[model samples]
Target: MKHQATPYFTFNGNAGEALDYYKQIFHGEVINLQTFGEADFETPEEMDQRVMHAQFKKDALFFMVSDSFTDQNVKTGSNIALVLECESTDEIQTYYDRLKNDGNVLMELQDTFWGATYAKVKDPYGITWDLNYTKEQ
Candidate 1:
């Protein structure tokens, strides 16, 4: 199975601005972007316009970013995470199970609105991992 890792940035806010800046610098295409207002989750009116998720792609490289929810604790240095994009469900499940040992599961593996089996975990060493497996289109 194929797997790739990409950097994920969590911003207190202004993720759209950050993504726009990166798009200019990297000259990449905005693959997908979704705001909290567009999601099924209930968000504060003030944060409804904030970016819930965004993806940028330049050639074979990909990057992602999102604005942190108001209730979430987000610090600058600790806001970065590694995202593993797996090619198969088994691949994602395997990694998730292995990494979750002695680690905290921030979000259990489940189907996401973006059409992927996804999960978030903080490894023993304190590094966060975002695991995702998107079905073949």
Candidate 2:
């Protein structure tokens, strides 16, 4: 199975601004940018313009960023996480189980609205990981 890790940044707001700045500096292409307003479910009017997810790639490196949910707390120093993109469901479960052994499982593995199996875990060393497995198109 393939495993790729990308840096994920959580922003209280201004994710789009940050992505734009990074793109300017890194000269990368924005692969995807989705706003909360475009989601299938309903979102507050104020949050409609907030970024739900975004990704950019520069050479061999990929970066992701998103605005935090209204109910969530996101701080600057601790706002970064490692996102693991797994190739298969088995890889997702295996990594989740192993990493969550003595760590905190913030979000249990489940199907997401974006059609992916996803989970969030804080490993024993206090590093957070977001695991995801997307089915082939």
Candidate 3:
């Protein structure tokens, strides 16, 4: 029953600076930093040098940050978006299939290497969504 979307920002190779500045301005806590050079990135030459993801938290607020991949002509202003976490596989799969009708899917819905059901799609509205549903134990 969680409706909150985790906002993921995409910087143009300035994610570290952006996250740091925001942390200072909001007095936030910068948590994990996942760079693109890690094993998750296939084309590290294009993404390895960039920040894959970073977490910033303060008070009741929390968000993530990263850089837009240079391999694609990603829009600067509208590069990032909400990551929706569905409660169930059926819910997420159904939502993903429905959302991808006219949508550009970045990744097909499948079990990720991290052991989670994951998919990404950019809706016609130009908003990128990372839809994730953790496998129920």
- TM-score-sorted candidate list, best first: 2, 1, 3
Instruction: Give Cα-based local distance difference scores for all models.
Output: 0.88, 0.89, 0.82
Q: After superposition, how far is residue 10 of candidate 3 from its true place, in Å?
A: 0.7
Clashes of 1: 0
RMSD of 1: 1.9
Q: For candidate 3, report its TM-score.
A: 0.84
Tens-digit lDDT string for candidate 1 (1-137): 45567899999888988888888999998767989999986788988889998888999888899999776778888999999888888889999999888899999999987788999999999999999888765
Which regions of candidate 1 are displaced past 4 Å?
none
Candidate with more favorable, higher TM-score: 2 or 3: 2
TM-score of every candidate relative to the true structure: 0.87, 0.90, 0.84
Q: How would you encode candidate 2's per-residue C-alpha lDDT over 1-137 as one tens digit per residue?
A: 45567889999888988888988999998877899999878999888999999998999978889999776778777899999889899999999999889999999999988989999999988799999999776
Model 3: per-residue Cα lDDT over 61-132, one tens digit each: 988888876655557678778899899888898879988998999889999755689899998888888998
RMSD of each: 1.9, 1.6, 2.1
